[model samples]
Target: MVMAHNPKIQEALDARDALASAITRAGVQLPAMDVRTPWAADADEDEEREGDARYALVHLGVCSASVAVLLADVIVRGLTS
Candidate 1:
């Protein structure tokens, strides 16, 4: 669906986009959590790798939050329309 047709969804998407842009502008280079799994079952990795995993978790958290907003908007629209 075209987000422009729904003002509330469009606004939410815009906010998410702005947040992602702001994170980029802050020079925090986050990896693509959507493409890669954020964690592993084995917990024997080195400290650096663990740190990277933690960072990926943070990125995933942000991505999940944005997705939740979008999903909620879509669900609400579907039910209401």
Candidate 2:
């Protein structure tokens, strides 16, 4: 399950792609990302707000970290058993 919906996920994904392309090219540096979330239509609009993007990104990062931790924990437990 995705814990947070970093509004900039799309941009991040795009930048990752661009970086891959740049690696193939000789030389070219780009600028930082500039993304925006659209006006939402739900009470959870709080999640879609511009300011909340950071929070979402943090939450997402935490969620990912948690998953890694959980997996490592399980592996350790299994090894010990």
lDDT tens readout by residue for model 2, 1-81: 222355455455565556536433523322332333333564275566544543222112223555456545655766799
> TM-scores for all candidates?
0.33, 0.26
What 10-residue stretch in candidate 1 is worst by lDDT?
Answer: 50-59
Measured with C-alpha atoms, the lDDT of residue 40 in candidate 1 is: 50
Best by TM-score: 1
What would the per-residue lDDT of candidate 1 be over residues 1-81, giving only the tens digit for each residue? 222334444454565566567545644433442213234554445633422433221123444565566656655766799
Residue 35, candidate 2: alpha-carbon lDDT = 34
